[model samples]
Target: MRYPILIEEGSDTTAFGVVVPDLPGCFSAGDSLDEALDGAREAAAAWIDAALDAGMPVPSPTKLEDARRLSGYEGWTVGVVDLDQALFDDSIERVNITLPKRILRRLDDLAAARHQSRGAFIADLTMVTK
Candidate 1:
C-alpha cells in the first residue's frame, strides 16, 4: 500500500526524513532521498503489520470529499495516498535472521529514524525479504 509520504531534506543534502500521515504511527529517515524512500516503504510495511497485529482497522485513504470536510482547518495540510490491496496481501517468504549486536543496532536505528517499533520493523523485514 502506497501512502502519501512527506519528505523533508535535512541540513545535509543527503540526509532526509519521511512521514506517512495516514499512518501517523510510521516515519522514516535516510542518508539520501532514495534511501529515505526505501525506508519509508519499509516503514509503511512495518506500520501495517503492527496495526494488523493489534487488530486495529487500517484507515482507508482519505478521499477528496474527506479533505474538503477539513477545509479551513488551522495549521494542517492533507495529502491523499493510494494503497493497493494486492500489494498489501503479497507476502513471499519468512527467514529467521539472527544478526550480530552491531547490525541489530543499525536496524534499530533505521527503524527509530522512521518512528517504527522494532516488532513492526522485524515483521516488515520478514514479509519482504528475498
Candidate 2:
C-alpha cells in the first residue's frame, strides 16, 4: 500500500516534519528528507498495527492529488510511503513446506523449549526478523 504524505520543509533550526494524511494522527520527523520519509513509513506501520490491535478499521490511502488538495499543506512537499501489505495482514493461513530433517529437528526443539507450537514459533521468528 502507498500512503500519501505531506512534508514540511525543515530549516537549520528545525527537523523535517511529515504527516500521513491517510492515517489520522500519524506523523513523524527527522533531520533530513530521507530520514523524514523513512520515519513516515515506520509511523504508518505502527499506526496500522495499533488500529488493528484496537479492532479499528485501517484507512485506505488517498490519491496524491487528493491529499495535495487537503487544507493546511500549502508550500509543503508531497511524497508517498510504500508499505508491505503482508506486514499488516493478521489473517491465519495454513501451508505445507518441506525442510531438511536436521533443520526440522532443531525447529521442533526450539518450539518445545519455548512451549509454543511449531507454527507459532515460526510466526514469532518471522515478525521479529521483519
Candidate 3:
C-alpha cells in the first residue's frame, strides 16, 4: 500500500530527508529534493523487502495526524504524498450491476446532489439501510 512519506524540510544536518512511517526505521536523506526522493525510493524498496522477509505487517502511509505528531522533531516540516494509490487499490473490490431505468435515474440524481457516484450512493445506502 502507498504509505505516506514525510519529508522534514528544515534540518541542519540534512537538506532533505524522508521518513516512511509505515516502515519503521525506513528513512533516507539527501542534500537536495531530487536526491531525497531517490533516497526515499531506495529506502522504500529495502523496507518492503525486509518486511516480506520477516513476514511483518506492512503499514499504510502515515496520515496528516500522524505526520503532525512529528512536529516535535527539531527543524523538521512534514510533506505527505498520495502517490501509492495502486498499492492500496487491492483493499477494495469492484463490482458491476444492472438497475431498472427509473431506479438508475433516481440514483443518478441522488448521486449528483451528494456529489457522489451511483455506486458510492448505493454503498452508503447499503450501510444505513436494513
Query: Which is the leading candidate under lDDT?
Result: 2
Give the least accurate 10-residue stretch of model 1, judged by summed lDDT.
Answer: 71-80
Candidate 3 C-alpha RMSD relative to the actual structure: 13.7
Give TM-scores for every candidate, taking all chains together and pairing residue i with residue i: 0.50, 0.71, 0.51
Candidates arranged by TM-score, highest first: 2, 3, 1
Q: Model 1, 1-130: lDDT tens per residue?
A: 4455566665565467766766876777788777777877777777776677566877666554454455333333334344546545636575677989999999999899889987778766876763
Error of 3 at 53 (Å): 1.7
Q: Write the per-residue lDDT of candidate 2 for residues 1-130, one digit (tens) a residue.
A: 8889999999899999999988999999999989998898989998998788677999888999998999999998888999999867889999999999999999999999999999999978976774
- lDDT for 18 in candidate 3 is 80
**lDDT score at residue 80, model 3, on the 0-100 scale:** 48
- Every candidate's lDDT: 0.66, 0.91, 0.69
The deviation in Å at residue 25 for candidate 1 is 2.3
TM-score of 1: 0.50
Clash pairs (backbone) in predicted model 3: 3-61, 4-61
Better of 1 and 3 by TM-score: 3
